[model samples]
Target: MTVNSVLVLGGGFTGLTSAIALALRGVENVTLVERAPAWARVGHGITVQGNALKVFQDIGVVDEILRRGFGADGVTLFHADGSVMMRLQTPKTGGEDLPATLGALRADVHEILVERALELGVKFRLGTQVVSFENHGDSVSVLLSDGTTEFWDLMIAADGIKSSTRPKLGITAERASSGLGIWRGVTNRLPEMTGGIAYPAPGDEGAYKVGYTAISATQCYVFVLCEPQRTPNDLPDWQEMKRLMEPFHGEFDWLRESLNESTYLNFQEIEWIFVEEPWHRGRVIALGEAVHAVPPLIAQGAAQCVEDALLIADYVTREGDLEAHLTEFQERRIPRIKGVVDASLQLAYWECHPGSPDAQPGRVMAQALAELVAAP
Candidate 1:
């Protein structure tokens, strides 16, 4: 049965992408509800991997993304002093036609996605969410925060790791902390900072890793991954961040010096959650971060989320057996989602425990990427 009306919870990457894909596929009525009154445009840069770029291409936004973001050929791992440790030619998971990675500010990416979704006639309501939902045999009835009741053929939950709709479906999944925190900010892009660069060595303040990537022609994003067990109840001052990053040389010095009160800095503890199978019950389904949220160690979180959106759009627009299609969606996505979540967790574990014998980040990353290269 073709779903004529769909309600999408959350307006992040997953929801927005799903709305765009569904509208493009000719769904008559698609509405996206976001809890936030306005877009959260404040965030550090993000690396949109090649696999994710494929989804953007499918949805017809790849050219705009490339225009607004910086494309890089490969990644380089550097020693503490900025000396080269290893150079890797990353696989073009999207295709040979796309770069291995594209870095863009979070605000830019969000705007692009929202613009595309709006252009396709996907309705959006801000500062509103699902108050409750009742899934009847064939359709789902949703009670929204706006004191309105709407009946839709399907409901999709992309409401982040702590999804309120999960409990309505009797799914109990809780996000677990990675015991690590990160500091991120943007600054002027140095001429030599051509691609993604990482420093794996420990810094002065027990920072496990430091990395930076160009997000635009003249700007870059920087991050410092600190050791776990530190409470981040308050945002640290620029001096504290600068002190923590003082151990490295080269571009680190530049980044360290670039810190100021004007810099848009942010800090947060990393957390993840992976829900078990049966992602759908009745006519409601969960996808993206709501089902599987992982750390960005391997940069597959957005890619997987976009994949889920594309698949959901494909399945829900079909002309037969909704339950079977939902089941098939979970079946097809489980292997890939499991691989990404496991690899990301392993990488987080390795970072938290530096010398664990079981840590093989490179191998895990390679295996995960190999699996993701195939069409979802």
Candidate 2:
């Protein structure tokens, strides 16, 4: 295939990063299609680890991201009764010599990415969605929700966890629930909280896990995990979520109070999906949450997507054979990303069985695997 213009589906972090990367490599024509009426992020804060930070730096958006974000050196794990369990450090890697991790609102990061993509001359077609595509050997014809069709040399799907393009590509992956759901929010009042704390409870049925980090002195991000259940659609029922967090009321009183006072909260169900065999077919390729949607246990979901964008751009720009390039992309990333998925699942299991001395080994194993995969 003679590659020229590329069509990108979805305008989230992955889609934006992919477009920016393609433009940076001098790919003249690239169009980003988003289903939403406007470009916006739907979540609270996200943790950008070192590996992801490196990618951002390479893409020329790290400084802006860090300007609007906060960094942390390590994460501290605690028990439900305010007892310290473990403190894991995220040290800097050799390449960048920057901070270990960064925490920022999703909107800020998305804005930086979109701004860079726009600056690179990538076209943004918001309110437009790719309904279907016909791969015609040499080119792919993309059908948009606006009742228009366009042909492109390549198509990349960066749509999120519930991607509309996945089914059209004949990719079948089962998303398994992790038996735990999370309630996340950001508070303007600081309750004298410590940075990077992951607290696990004592049992499997109703274990409470909390992760706290300071976005600013007066602003804090808190994420609590509990048993999975149906949540009403109206404003995330902060009061009911407080009720579910009653067990940790006395233990992490500040967190409980934060939840009670928080006016904005979002509920997320933890799930993981594995796409069988090839990650790409013909001219259509799925990246980010569209390919492997894992739980937030490792906090590498978005980062891995960014890595995919960088690697894909590099492969296409350097390699002549398109099929061989896609094959190499899958082979190079599958084992590494799969290890991350497995390690995250293991950590989720350990969090489920907190306080038990037996779970310590699982935690240790997870940390080891993380280090191994995180290593350059």
Candidate 3:
């Protein structure tokens, strides 16, 4: 089946990428509806891994991302006392030319996507949501919160992990929490901090980690993992975040000093969901966090989402059966997603249980990076 019109739910990386990919492939009438009135992302800074950068390159935005973001080659691991543990070069999963990792403000990346989508004539409806949807034999009819019903050749759920569209499509995947929350913010960058720097400090709770990466010439993103909680808790303030950074030394001392009452900080509770096989039913499908989400252990979430969008755009635009195309997409993606999710979970386990004999994050990371270097 040939798709002529598409409805994309959510305006995040997945939704925008889907809309842009489809539009770039000459799919007309691609409408992306976002629940937020304006673009908003909690984490101010984002790590654009090489694989995701490769997708951005394909979609014609990598140059802008690289220009606006800070590019780095490796990550330095340090102990709580600021002593070096190990440092290694990260794989350039995107290719030889692109940086292994690029850091930029989340808003900057979102703005770039929005501009590109608009340039491609992708329609955007902000402060809108899908109230309901029904999948027919060949098309999906959606009811928007604006009280309008529209039909499309295809509908994509990219609304994120807590997607309302998942249940509507009969996907039984539930959101899973890692039982940990993270405090993150952007601060002035230090000249010597070239690449990603991580500090794994042992605490009364466990071996939670903290780190910072340069987001720009003058700014870097800082983050610290909090103690696991029995349930979701309230948002943490900058003072609380400072207290969490107290154990950290070296660059963290500067990071802590950078925090104040005026500084804007954001707290994120780690949650994930992995939708099972049959990512689609009829003409409606789910991608990105709506289908799979992992902890930030490996930072592969965005890349996986981009891969999903690229594959969907490629297969859906091709001639033949839509169901077969979707099935093929799922088949191609499941193994990769499984590797990322499982390895990330292992890393998360290591963080929560410091001395567990089963926690081999190094082995897991090496194996995962090796597997991910190949084309998606």
Candidate 4:
């Protein structure tokens, strides 16, 4: 079992972090292949939870991320009418070892990871796609879209929700409807909003809800979730977005004006999935959205992926048997990841279908759990 080189597919947060972790461990022959022409992430903003921040610190990129990202105190939830329902504050645990939670553009985090990986001598192949692979007992031969083949001791598939490498590994996934569609955007003018507040709208009048968090004194990240609807493919029209937001306009004084003033409105169809038996044949492993994609309700998508990177790296470094390592990694991760997926789906259902008796109880339980976890 030669454990000299590793090939990481999909250079997103998970892939990049995995490569960096291996590189930091003196694994020189680490290669990251991304389908995009350059290093960039296609999302508005992401919240870095406490657990993930600790992982970043371990990997030596916490400072870089914090320097370039926004530090968020906590999250707040509200009714569509702007009445505060719940608030989760970042409790100060009496320890200097605790890492700060951050909310920043996904691109910033990706850039920081890519730069660190490159500095650590990790090879990055942007615009390159992994077409297929053949696992020959000791090594896996990966074929790229550009007619090139390479062999590596291990392969990490970090491709997103619709991962292409998953099928090749014989892992099947089941999609769970989130019951809501989301529109995310950023506005230059700061709205009278604070972090961690989730606004749930009144009865199914389009089932609209809006949330705003101050990324900076001058800028805010805003999002609106409603019953799913068809959105034009073109860059989301701000006017159309405003119109969609019309139903809830004036419902919440802060959110109503913010929606009208926001310049960027990007619509997304939210869906959840749980891959049955996350690990595949010995050499190949899937992480991040590829293995268990959850709705953004919990905001732990990236955090969970970061955890996966660390756990996989730790397992591989400690365990000699490749099959055993993969199995152990899945065993430790599947339960937690599935818990998050279920929790997120339940939250999405609560937000989308508020009136259903089944959803209400789950919503209350989920809220209580969230409060408990967020408690300082």
Tell me model 4's lDDT, rounded to 2 decimals: 0.70
Off by over 4 Å in 2: 91-96, 189-194, 198-207, 231-236, 249-251, 260-262, 353-358, 361-376
Mark the regions of model 4 whose C-alpha exceeds 4 Å error after superposition: 90-100, 189-192, 196-201, 231-236, 247-262, 358-376
Clashing residue pair totals per candidate (backbone < 3 A): 1, 0, 0, 7
| Candidate 1 lDDT over residue span 1-376, tens digit each | 3798999999989999999999999999999999999987788888899999999999999999999999986777777787887777777889889988898998898899999988999999999989988888888989998899999999999998888877767788788898788878888868778654555554334677788878898888888888654445464567667766776667788888988888888878888988885888998998898889898888889999999999899998888999999998899898888888888888888888886888777778877887777888
lDDT values of the candidates?
0.85, 0.75, 0.85, 0.70
Per-model RMSD to reference: 1.9, 2.9, 2.1, 3.7
**Candidate 2 residues 310-346, lDDT tens each?**
8887776664778788888888888777877877777
Provide the lDDT at 318 for model 4.
Answer: 60
Q: What lDDT tens digits, residue by residue, belong to model 3 across residues 201-221?
A: 444433277888899899888
lDDT of 4 by residue, 1-376 (tens): 2367999999888998898888877675889888989754556767676667777888998888777666765666665445566666553221235534566777778888888888899998889999989999878899998999988888999998888888888876655567788777776543445464444444436535666555555666667777676554553366555655555433234444555444656777787778767566867788888887777776677778888887777777664677787787788787677667767777776776566666663344345335324312
Model 1 residue 37 CA deviation (Å) reads: 1.4
Relative to the unseen true structure, what is the C-alpha lDDT of residue 202 in candidate 2, on a scale of 0 to 100?
45
The global Cα lDDT (0 to 1) of model 3 is 0.85
**Candidate 1 stretches greater than 4 Å from native:** 200-205, 229-235
TM-score of each candidate?
0.95, 0.90, 0.95, 0.87
What value of lDDT does candidate 2 attain over all alpha carbons?
0.75
